[model samples]
Target chain A: MTGSPVPPELYAEVLHFYARQMQALDGGDFESYAATFTADGTFKHSPKLPAAQTRQGITEALHEFHKKFDGDPVQRRHYFNHVVLEQQEDGSLSSTAYALVLTTRPGGRPDVGPSCVVNDVIVRDRGALRLKSRAVDHDQEFAAVAV
Target chain B: MTGSPVPPELYAEVLHFYARQMQALDGGDFESYAATFTADGTFKHSPKLPAAQTRQGITEALHEFHKKFDGDPVQRRHYFNHVVLEQQEDGSLSSTAYALVLTTRPGGRPDVGPSCVVNDVIVRDRGALRLKSRAVDHDQEFAAVAV
Candidate 1:
């Protein structure tokens, strides 16, 4: 069977949205990252990890995350590889993507982390689409210590 | 920057996989559902919910899920609406999509459940791609009931 056709606007929006997410994460712009969610949005890290069920919850958790990795000691990177977007009813969108992250200390070689699969729900807020929720599925265990 | 291109084979595999997943869930083909995973795969219901970390763990959980919903005596119908695909390293792929579920009971009208987002990681198994992991994110509660 032939594949379904993709809407151009939806396509463009999905790409832009994905980029913004990675940029915000890599840039350590917590406020921008938090703003991507709806006022009542959530962020779910993994199946076994605790989930931030609401916007406020996510903000609080992010604060904690930043505290641990707070120093601009070196570099933190989020790499987006494969991404899939599906349109839902009423302008809502769902997407899946793979992310590879590397965190390194100054003058140290970067270590590659486990592959991650992410699922996200997005809604059109005002005139732009914003993430409503994020679910991260990690394929391997996190490294306890590495540069 | 432009979005990355999705390979045709990868796209087909994803479409087929999700279709199978929807069919299995709705058709009550637990065997097929179990077959979709790798020998050591994981299934996460919601990022917040505990994940089924192993193939057997996921299968056992589904069995429990089936029994719990049996008393409800209803058919759970789920559909994948929008789908987006992204390619990654090592021939792996990632995707995101939106889902709408409709549940119906005998002599009862179908009720629509809140929307859901799906993120999946896929790897080429032999010649075809199989699900390595799935992370589900939802915007609404389970309609306060099953759907």
Candidate 2:
């Protein structure tokens, strides 16, 4: 992507948005996490899994995601890196990132959970940046487990 | 974190450097990977592990790192995101990012290896961007496994 420098304010806003989104997910606050997206936002966890569209759908999907680790007191942490944001021709922002998910059981060693690539479209709504669509591509082998 | 916008050229350069570095590591080309750093560059995998200083030291450490997964035909992939770069007071560039290391063994499902935070100091010498220091902070439990 080639263009003029990204404004500091825009970069700062995107950074802040991701921080809040991560905190919400880590704290199990699905409500807050869902709020980061637009009303018609869409989340694709993997190619095989049906996409979660709309705020309610996203929230339910996240709830089910959290339930996967039920019966085991495991802590989940997500790390993101190599985020590249660019302004699309339509004026919305498009982003690509990589994610690492780690899980640790009580008194047990940490285990790698999954690694995936994230592609997102961000739009401004009501004066705040929100996710329009997020398509996550999991590694081929990992996608089998994730789905 | 508050200042004028980062020059587009500088931002592009850092992005380009990381792309090359990741390619080298994924391709198991230690020679190319080691060349990404300065002569006195340092790599700190974790607090408990001894730091690797200088070009030779960094290359040797990577060699040993790759050896750990020996005897198993595995593919290693590194994904980075949330990269934030700022100009430091000393005129060098300081960057903070998150990384996901994934490994896939032959006929086995892909697994998450480690999720860590990467802090880097980048400098220009001979007209190319090179890493001067890279300090990685893994999650508490992950750090134990990494070291």
Candidate 3:
């Protein structure tokens, strides 16, 4: 068998990070979600909107963006697949994924939204993987991630 | 650092299997979806329902299942995460995942449905990985995977 270029532990760590981080976002624990990013991390949703440049900014932006959902009150979820990871010479990782957004009201049907792709710069922060940058590019307009 | 018990390539192959297989299911390609299973594969969705006993049966069941969606005509998606894989001594894989089913209509809101867990026995068939058995257990009643 050919040797794997990347370490298996790295894959485990990254997947673990996603499992916890996305749960925080979907579960409305914005603080815990934002904490997965580096202190100076940036989250850029689109070219039109300014990037959330810090952890505090990310939390605040989530709080504001969620205001609209309060009226409709459906649970929002993010599912990512086809995660391709490449390691930089400097030891950081560049990860890309196809992302899907799903929402549902209590006792209602689920609707899967527009297709999107996310590219991220992940780095080791105090021995754990943290996002240094996250750029979400939507193929079309979806109310959930509209910025 | 300790060595990884699981090979990195194993993780890669299992993920690749999921990526292609789920796309086939959500994309309305029942033949392609069923082809991923072993010829004698069994799919048991619940204790109440009899398992789809073979690949042909799996395809037929999918055709019948999608009839319900024809009137609604929304995309049905399966998203899986938190994958845990264990390898048997005989080189087969026992994989488990937390799954989410999403649905959406044309120009409509997306809904995320009930939580489910899927356990599968994956084995090599003609040098390619194929599902030997898939057992999906739902946490609650969800119309999408009612069978």
Candidate 4:
């Protein structure tokens, strides 16, 4: 409504998707977070990391990763800022943003981690944008806080 | 160009700026990266971090951080994806993108940190959309790798 001529509904749905992703991460609901993507969704961290080595066979991988975080912490925060969204030639959308993850371990300064940039390729699924692939670039490092 | 109705020149400039930023970082040219901002430019990690944290007086801080990498044996790669940019009401631009940071230390396996979503507010300065404030949100951890 304020910038480009993207359909109001499209923009709203995208924003909603982002909000839901953040909420799921903060709530420690990895199931929901993992569901935000399509079955063949790729989550590449780097070309060197084996966790997300390729664009194929990631649905099961996400499930496994979520299981790792299931019982690690009761509370976690996923913060996103400086988000930019672009519509591609095929009507699909792509976006990037900065993320900061914070964790709380009972009492003490929340563990603060690095600041990274996120790159995502999304598609329209059931009238909403579902991430097809997500890549994160950590640009800043902190003292490795717990959260 | 293919997505939004942004003027071609403005769009090209923005793209160029990002490419330059990435090149500077990869080449370990922190001074050039820092010069991309104005005297009052802001570099923020998250909502909870310090505001603007102006770089004008952070020379020592910048040097200390840059010293960690000797630029060899550490292969740092950053991927920018799904970029969406909008021309704002104030003639500035608002953008969001997903970022992925991958790092490989000397004789170590590559580590893929968390994903980040970047929200950038920029203004055209001297025919370029220089970054004004970059507020990063960590989808996992903060500054996991040097971008």
Best by lDDT: 3
Q: Candidate 1 vs candidate 2: which has greater DockQ?
A: 2
DockQ scores of the candidates: 0.01, 0.13, 0.10, 0.02
lDDT of 4 at B87: 74
* Model 2, span B39-77: residue lDDT tens: 888889786799899878888998898777666566667
Across A73-100, the per-residue lDDT of candidate 4 in tens digits comes to 4234556766677778887778888877
TM-score of chain A of 1: 0.83
State the lDDT of candidate 3 residue by residue for B13-81, as single tens digits.
677577667766766787887888888999886756788978789988888877886556566567788
Q: Which numbered prediction scores highest in TM-score against the true structure?
A: 2
TM-score of chain A of 2: 0.87
Kindly list the per-residue Cα lDDT of model 1 for residues A10-86, writing each as its tens digit: 65556556665665555556677777788888798767868785666777877787677543453455556556777
Clashes of each: 15, 5, 7, 58
Q: Say which prediction, candidate 1 or candidate 3, comes out ahead on lDDT.
A: 3
Candidate 3 Cα deviation (angstroms), residue A103:
11
TM-scores, all models, native as reference: 0.48, 0.59, 0.56, 0.46
> Which is better, 1 or 4, measured by lDDT?
1
> What are the per-residue Cα lDDT tens digits for candidate 3 across A1-147?
112245556766777788888989999999998999999999886756899989999999889888988778888888777565677998889877667877889899866666566789999999888999999965444322321
Worst 10 residues of 4 chain A by lDDT: A102-111
